[model samples]
Target chain A: MKFGIGMFGDSGYDTKTNRFRDPEKRLKEIVEEVIQADTLGIDLFAMGEHHREDYVVSSPETMLAALSTVTKNIILSSGVNVISSADPVKLFQDYAMIDLLSGQRAEIMAGRGSFIESFPLFGQNLNDYNELFAEKLNLLLRLNKEEKINWKGTFRAPLKDQTIFPRPKREIPVWIAVGGTPTSVLRAAQLGLPIMFAIIGGNPRQFLPLVDYYKEQYALAGHAKDKMEIGVHAHTYIGDSRQAVLKAYYPAYSFQMNRIGKERGWSGSFTQSQFEAGMSMQGALYMGSAEEVTEKLINTIELFGLTRYIAHI
Target chain B: MKFGIGMFGDSGYDTKTNRFRDPEKRLKEIVEEVIQADTLGIDLFAMGEHHREDYVVSSPETMLAALSTVTKNIILSSGVNVISSADPVKLFQDYAMIDLLSGQRAEIMAGRGSFIESFPLFGQNLNDYNELFAEKLNLLLRLNKEEKINWKGTFRAPLKDQTIFPRPKREIPVWIAVGGTPTSVLRAAQLGLPIMFAIIGGNPRQFLPLVDYYKEQYALAGHAKDKMEIGVHAHTYIGDSRQAVLKAYYPAYSFQMNRIGKERGWSGSFTQSQFEAGMSMQGALYMGSAEEVTEKLINTIELFGLTRYIAHI
Candidate 1:
């Protein structure tokens, strides 16, 4: 099984200043972090996009390109590229260049982002959210496969025999990232693409039905069963002891959860009970000592028949 | 005076296969070259954008981002980001991230690119070329200065109280690159922006009048004289001896010139006499022994009182 690490590059909260830490310092730390991960033989590193003061990176591809020259062996990917609000032509070309720079170690994980800031920021309308993703994803897939393309789409300017340059040595890997959406799962299955489920809260086993559905639909769609790949991404933190990790991770974790929950109008603050429950064997949060986390990971891997597991730290 | 080097990252012609050299090899070589330049204490390195098979880099910012981590001291910049067809918001954010990554060493040299490939590739109309550059430049400058912006333009969606994130540590230097266009020079002067003249062809002294015009206009516009900056970018090659350089560089140089000449419908083949003239003191080409090129560079710098000179090799 493939194991990977993921980061949103959040600017750390500094209680002394009562504000976010400097993004530059955080970005430098991320470079060092990835280099260390590569040295430790991590399988992949996925960076997520966030256009905000709290996050250091808005362009995952840029961060990936920066790491391409410094690291070896680890796959560089966007955790979710927010393709709905992105220009696919530009996105494909950028990643294509990264692929060449990294010796074919680049992948793209496409998702309708969990955040809405990118919509108006990139001049995309919220009303066309679903349609925008579907259309742009179609364009992105076509750009990967075709040399010269003649295409028409509602959201973007029409292409009349256009070709993107610096083609990849091989077709770059494209994975679908879903958040408990069956239609999204059906789409990936129908297209025979690998799927990554974001199981950030609640019991990890709850996603088994969706995983089973994906497998059934994938087989019914005439895709090879052995070729199907399934993966899960969850909030994770590890330390020498459960108490030590909790002491180090809980304050920041709860603060972030409450901050986002407040933004989304979710009821109540994040409590110790919720955190404790999430740290359990069936829980989604992959936290605790190395031995405990390893056992949980093995169980989850077997439960989902996962080909990949990403610890979102 | 500040000195810099520039490259278009041309995939060299392979005489044996009669094909372009592999771009992957060229890209890796570029990273090594920049590292060497940085080690040698070059003031800056500028990478140009090209959307074609012969050039390896289509995104200059990507290349700059890659170099930012590996190199120290050398300023990383887009030699001439084709900003006319580019999204200014995206451009600013990308460079802002690069600036933070490099401790404020990132810069942008904006230009309406010499080639037209990006126009159609990015779905921009050639008729709106000049206007597009004007509008985008205005937006880019504002993004550098303002924390909150409200802007409306013909080519892009209006920004309503928008604030781009991951702000730069300082106003990232913005320079205008002109191909001997008086109005373009006047605009840069009027805006109090540094201007870079691309003196790639003809006698180098021929640009004296235009340089004088810029100095006059810059003063007339009431910008600080001491703060004024002017730079020149020229086609350059340096070697141990003229004969050694000629023997090695002539075939490939003539091939590229003839190939582009064919595309632009320019008459006649590139001849040896023309190459010899270009290598002379009066020529724009900076090809010769290190002493000869240094003397020529000093002369050109004094002739225009250049604050900076970029050898586009």
Candidate 2:
């Protein structure tokens, strides 16, 4: 099974000064941390795409392209493509460029991004979210496979004999990031694409049934079971002890969860018990020492027979 | 004055081996080369965005993001942005992300790309190129200045009080890449933007007059002369001997020029004399040792009073 690390590119807060240092310096530090992770036998390094203050990465492809030069073996992937709001042609061209720069190490996970801010910022409609994703995803899939494509969609202009250049060394690997959406899972299966489960909260094993559903649906769609790669994404940290891990991660984690929870209408304070539960739960939060992380990952890998494991380390 | 190195991220052709290595390896090498150049006092390391196989960089932002981690103290800039075909919001967001990744080293040069392939591929109209660039550029400029903006245009939907997030550490510097168009020059002046002259194959001094034109226009437009920095972009290389440099660069240069020339109806069987002329000609190719290149750059700097010099190394 392949293992990957994800970065939100968060700069740790300096409580003493109570002010963030230069963001560029913080960003460079975050990238170097990822590079360090890449050297530690990590198979992939995925960066989240966010248009928020806390999260630094808005162009994951650009970060991946830069990472392509620094690391030797890690496959550079984008955590989300924001398909509903982004132009498919530009995404294809950008990732293809990433493939060219990285020697085919570029992989993209497409979904309707979790953040709604991108919609208005990009002059897109939240009302057409489903339709926009459907149309754009179809076009993106078509562009990924064909060198020259003729595609017309409501969201964008039509292409007549249009060829997107600088094709990948081979077909770029694409995954559909589904956040507990059965229809999205089915769509991915129907399209013969891999599914990346965004299991940010709850137990990891809770997703087993969904994994089963994907496999059955994929098999029903005539795709071999072995051909499908079941993957999971979750927040993580590694430290000397459980206390150390929580001490390092809790404030940021609580801040993010609370901020997102407020927006999503979830009311709950992040507690120590929940953090402990999440760490020890039969799920994919690989947070602990190297051994602890390895143990948790091995268990999850064994449980799901996962082909890829992505952790926000 | 600042000096920058640009790489095409060229993918090599193999005649003997039918199998080919991907450009990712070459890109890694190029990053190392840029780091070396940075150590050697190169001010900026820029990569162009191209979608053709002959050129490898599909997303210069991604490459720059990776470079952000590995190198120190070098400005990371995109060689050009295809403003006419790209979504400006995404463009700004991506560059903002690069800024976060590279510690405010990110800068972009916006242009109406030399190639027309991006138009059809992105489902945009070739006829509406001017309007598209105008609207997008206007939006981008607004986005750059404000955290939240209300924008509406013909090309895309309306944005109602939207703010792009992950704001840069500082104001992201942008330059207009103009190919000697009077209107383009005026646009830069009126917008109070810096202008980069894409002088590929002409007398450098000829553009000196255009530089004067820009200065006069900027003053006429009620802008300070120092607010607008004039830069020159030209192909370059440094090798052991003139003969060696010519032999190495000619084949690739001829192949690229002729490919574009065919579409544009320019005739040329590049010869040794023309190559020599380009080397000797003021404001032409920069092919020589470090001292040779430095001398040539100093001459151009003195002759044109250029504030920035971008070498397509």
Candidate 3:
């Protein structure tokens, strides 16, 4: 089983000041963190994409490209590149170069994005959200599989016998990142692509039906069972003991939760009771001592038949 | 004065085999070459973009992003980003992140491109060439100066109160690269933007008039005189001895010149006599022994009042 770490390059919250950290400092910290992850023998480092002040990275591929030179033995990937609002041609070219630069350790995870800011930013229409993802993913897959492409699509201009340069030494892995959407999972399974479910909140057991659906659909689609890859991403923190970890992590964690929650119109502030429930074995938040966290990870891995697990810190 | 090295990640040509070298190897060499440049105290490294098999880098920013981690003290830039066919918003965001990553060492040199391949690949029409560059450059300048933008253009999507994230530590320098186009030179001067003249062939003295024109227009536009930055990019090779350098560089140089000449439908192949003329003190090619190259560079820098010189290899 592969274990990985993921981050959105979150700008640190200085609880005393109640202000966001400088993005440049946060970006440098991210680079150091990933280098440390590589030193610690982490299998993967997935960088998240966010085009907001709270996050330092707008282009995960760009950040990954920076890390490609400094890190070794870590598979660099986008936790989720909002591909629906991106040009797949450009995306393919960027990641292909990253693959070559990193000696073949680059992967792309496509998603519709958990936020809608990119839609207007890139001139993409919100009404065409599903269609945009479907069409762009189609184009991206073709760009990967074919040396020359002749494709037409509604969202972007058509490619006429075009080929992107700086081709990767090997086929870069492309994963589908979904936020517990059955239709999204079904699409990934049907396409025989690896699926990464982002389980940020609620009960971990609730996703069991979606995981089973993906496996059933994947098998029905005649993909090799041994080659099937399923992964989970969840908010996680680990320390020598649960109390010490909670003491350090909760202020910043709760601040971010409430900040994003306020934007999303969540009715109640995150409470210690809810946080304790989330830390429980049945909940999605993976936080505790090393042994406790490991046990929880193993349980989730076995329950979902996952090939990979990513701690979204 | 700033002196820099620029490359298109040109895949080496094997004369005996009459074949191109591997791009993966060339890319690694590029990283090494830039690191060495930084170590040697080169002020800048400008990567070129090409959407062809002969050139490995199609996204100079991607290559620059990769180099940001490995090299320190070298300004990372696109020799010419072919910005006419690019999205200025994305370009600004990428360079902003690159600037933050490299401690304010990121720059963008915008050009209409010497080749037409990117236009077709990016779904842009040749007919809209001038308009595209004009519109994109305008938007790019606004993105650099403003916290939020409300922009509309004929070529790309309009921006409405949009602000790109991960803002640079300082305003990223944007230079205009012109290939002896009087109109292009005028636009750069009027905008008070730095100008990089690409002098690939013919007599260097011939550009004196264009350089003077830029200075006159720039001063007329009420820009600060000392702030005016003018640069020249030319093919350059430096060696210990003139004969040894000729023997080593001539075969490959003539081969590339003829190859590109053929593609452009030039009348005759590149001859050694022409190469000899190009190597003269009056010529544009900055090749010869160290003393000879220094003399030629001094002459050019003095003649054009250049602030920066980029040796394009």
Candidate 4:
């Protein structure tokens, strides 16, 4: 199984200042973490885009470009590029540069980002979020396939058969990252794109229907079953013991979630019951000992036959 | 004086096939070339942006990002980011990323590009050429100063106290590149931006008036002479002998210049007399042996009191 790590560049809450620490220092830690992961034989590493003050990475490709230099072998990508707020041509150029630097180890995971801050930040309308994402994804995919693009779209300027320069030596894999929505799964499958199912909460088994639907859609879309791919991303952290892992991760996790919760109008308060349940067998969280995590991974792989598994910490 | 090398990432024309080479291969050569330049103790290295097929880079920051990994100690910069055709926020993000990756070895040379192809490629109009550049440059300067900007402009969407993330750790020096234009020089001087004068053609003495005008304007604008800076970029090639250098670079240089010349209604043909004249003392082109080149650079530096000298090969 392909295994990887994901970072959001979030400086976990500082108790003294009661705010995140310097993002620059946190970004440095990420570079060190990636170097360590590469040495440890990790298959890939991805970073997510977040626009709020809590997250340092508003541009994932920027972080990837930094990581591309210090890490070797580990495929570099955006856990999700938050393509909904970005221009596809620019995204292609940025990641293509990373691919070249990493010797073709770059991939782009496009998503209608979980966060909405980028919408207003880039002067995008919240009403058009879904449409904006679909349109941009279409544009992003077309760019990877063709260098000289002649296209018109509503949300972005037209490409008048203009060529995008410095194309990568190999085609970059552009994956679609999806949540619990069947429509998102079906859309990815229909496009013959790989899907990275983000199961950050609840039971992993609950996503079985969406996975099954995606495969069915893949077949209907005439994609070869052998070539189709599925990846899993979850809230994960490993420690010597289950209690130790929870103790170390919960405070920060609760802080971040509550911080995000304030913005989205949801109660981000954490309870021990929810945490314990999420860490149990078949649960969404991967917080546990090596054996417990391994067994959980095995069970999930057997359930969905995942091609790749990524844990976010 | 700060001495550096400049690469345009131009694909040399193939005599047999009569076509430019693969840009991917050319880009790889650029990487190796920068590594060698770094080892040779070059102080800075700059890459130019072009949208046409003959040139590989449309995004200089992308190339700089790739180079940031393989080389050290060289200050990375764009020969000029065609700010007229770019989003200033995006340009800031890309270069900031480069700065982070390179540990503060990053700069930006902003220019109303000598070539106009990018203006059209990025959905801009030639009619608004000067205005577009000035407006975008104002925004770019604002970005460098403030983390959260409330900027409103004609060409771009309004930024309502929006934050541009991943600001560089240190101040990123932004230099203005000019091609002997009185207005451009005066603007650079008035804005207190350093100037990178491109002396690609004609007698070097011809630019003296414009340079002097800049200094007078800079003083009137209240910028201290000691604090102000200037740089020069010229067509250059080095070899064992002047004869070898000319014969080696002439074919490709003429082809590119003429190709560009044809579009601008000028005769692209080169004669031995003009070539010889251009390589002499007080000439523009810097094609010669180590001693000859050094003498030329020293003469020019003495003539203009140049702070930096970059040779475009």
lDDT of 4 by residue, A37-132 (tens): 999999999898877667777778877876776677999989888888888887887777778767788999988988777787667898998899
Compared to the true structure, candidate 2 yields what TM-score? Answer: 0.88
Across A9-43, the per-residue lDDT of candidate 2 in tens digits comes to 76555657876555667667766777787789789
Arrange candidates by lDDT, highest first: which order?
A: 3, 1, 4, 2
Q: Candidate 1 docking category? A: medium
Candidate 3: segments with Cα more than 4 A from true spot = none
Across B191-306, the per-residue lDDT of candidate 1 in tens digits comes to: 99999999988999999998999999999999999999999999889988999778888888999999899999999999877887998999888999999999999999999999
Chain A (alone) TM-scores for all candidate structures: 0.98, 0.93, 0.98, 0.97
Candidate 4 lDDT at B146 equals 87
Cα deviation of A18 in candidate 3 (Å)?
4.0
TM-score of each: 0.98, 0.88, 0.99, 0.96
Q: Whose DockQ is higher: candidate 2's or candidate 4's?
A: 2
Stretches off by above 4 angstroms in model 1 are none
Q: How many clashes (backbone N, Cα, C below 3 Å) per candidate? A: 0, 13, 0, 0
**Residue A300, model 2, lDDT:** 77
Per-residue alpha-carbon lDDT of candidate 4 for residues B1-313, written as tens digits (9 for 90 to 100): 8999997888777869987787666777788899899999999999998877678787888788777766879989899889998888778877776787677888999989888877656678889989998999998898888888889989888888887666677768999999988999999999999999999888887888888888899999999889888889998877788898788876777667777778888864666767778888767889888789888888888878799999998
- What lDDT would each prediction earn against the true structure? 0.91, 0.79, 0.92, 0.84
Worst 10 residues of 4 chain B by lDDT: B267-276
TM-score of chain A of 3: 0.98
